[model samples]
Every structure is written in C-alpha cells, then in structure tokens.
Target: MLKQFCEHCGEETEHKEVIKQKPSKYGKSKKEQFKAFLSGFFGGVASQVGASLDLIDRYVVCKKCGRKKLENLGDEFQ
Candidate 1:
C-alpha cells in the first residue's frame, strides 16, 4: 500500500492502485475515426520515445483526496 497525504481528508492515507480505461469513441464520423486513429498512433509512438528517453513521469492518486501526484522515485531507466 502507498501512503500519501490527502488534501481532502487532510491526512496521510494508504492508496490503492487505480487502473482507468481510455474512453472509447461513442458517436464519431468515419473521418473523425480515421483522424483519431492516426492521432493515437502518432501519440503512442511519441510516448514510446519519451519512455525510452526517461522523460515521462508517472504518478499515483491519493486514496482519500483523489489527488494525482508524482512521487520522487528518481530517474526511471528503461
């Protein structure tokens, strides 16, 4: 369990890992879908590059406050 300060509760609390799903396209046109697909592909590539370069910072949310905060875990070398 991860212990972090919660702004809402005003105290430190243990947090559970929350895995959120990427929202799906509900009512998009064909053209919009194509554009979104291209954008997602390029965005994924860019994120891969950033991850390999250790330029991405990951974070966890506070259990009580639901505040997303990055812990100082030093550099992540892939």
Candidate 2:
C-alpha cells in the first residue's frame, strides 16, 4: 500500500495499486477448473498462475474510502 491523498476520503490514506487480469469467466468454468486441478498438485497450480498473468486494467484504490483511480502503465509513478 502507498500513502496518497484520496479526494473522496478527504485525507491521505493507504492505497492499493493493482494490475487487473482477465476475468475468470473468459475460459473454463471455476468449478470445472478446480476439479481438473485436483489431478495434479504443483503442475496444476503453476499452469493456473502462468495463464492468469495477462493483465489489462490498472487501478489505485483508496483504503480509507472505496474509490478507484485509473492509471496507465506507461506513465512514471510519482
């Protein structure tokens, strides 16, 4: 978390910056995926982690108030 001023909270608070990934619903269903993972331990976990790294949306969310500010990856972080 980074200390930043939140306009909504009207104070400086901790903010969580997250690089959003593709939605889970885009491919195999959660229930089915879980069952498939049960077949292999490390391999299954590794595959899941590797596949989900396709990130898109980036957001900085305030901890004090649930407000989100969109950020671009190309911009330098101040």
Candidate 3:
C-alpha cells in the first residue's frame, strides 16, 4: 500500500513491490576463508558463512503512464 509520485504520470500512483538479487562477489580468497573460519569458530554463526548476497530494490511503476522508477519506501516496503 505504497503511493509514489510518478513523474511520468504527474501524479501520485500506487506502486508494486519488486525484489531483485544483487550480484555477489565471486570467489573467496585464502584470507577471506581464514576470516570466515575464525568467525565461525569464535562466533559460532557459520550458517551463512559465504552465502551469496541479495538486496531488496524497491521500484514503483506508474499505473497511468507505466513509468518504472526506483523508490525508497522505508522498512515497510522491504
């Protein structure tokens, strides 16, 4: 239930939620590996040691003009 001001439509319009995955860094070097090992051993949080990263990119499309744009709608959007 997020409303955004659409430049294309020149008015406020309802937007839809869009989830996108960001490209993750490829490969972990030896140093990174050692750090992960140490963190796992000390912190005991090894579940996602080297998992690929994802980002939630919020976007809004003008229902009237169909213009797509990136928008920051705060935590509720996330």
Please list the Cα RMSD from the true structure of every candidate, rounded to 1 decimal place: 7.2, 6.5, 9.2
lDDT of the structure predicted as candidate 3: 0.54
Error of 2 at 37 (Å): 16
Over 5-77, each residue of candidate 1 has an lDDT whose tens digit, in order, gives 7777788887765433233452377887676566556666665444322333446787666787754334553
Error of 1 at 68 (Å): 0.9
Candidate 3, superposed: residue stretches over 4 Å from native: 26-54, 72-78
Model 1: worst 10 consecutive residues (lDDT sum): 18-27
TM-score of each: 0.38, 0.47, 0.46
Q: Model 3 Cα RMSD, Å?
A: 9.2
Q: Which lDDT value does model 1 have at 39?
A: 59
| Residues 1-78, model 2: lDDT tens digits | 598888898999999996654344434787766654453344445434443233335679998787998764442331
Q: What TM-score should be assigned to candidate 3? A: 0.46
| Candidate lDDT values, in order | 0.57, 0.61, 0.54
Residue pairs in clash, model 2: none
Could you give the candidate ranking by TM-score, starting with the highest? 2, 3, 1
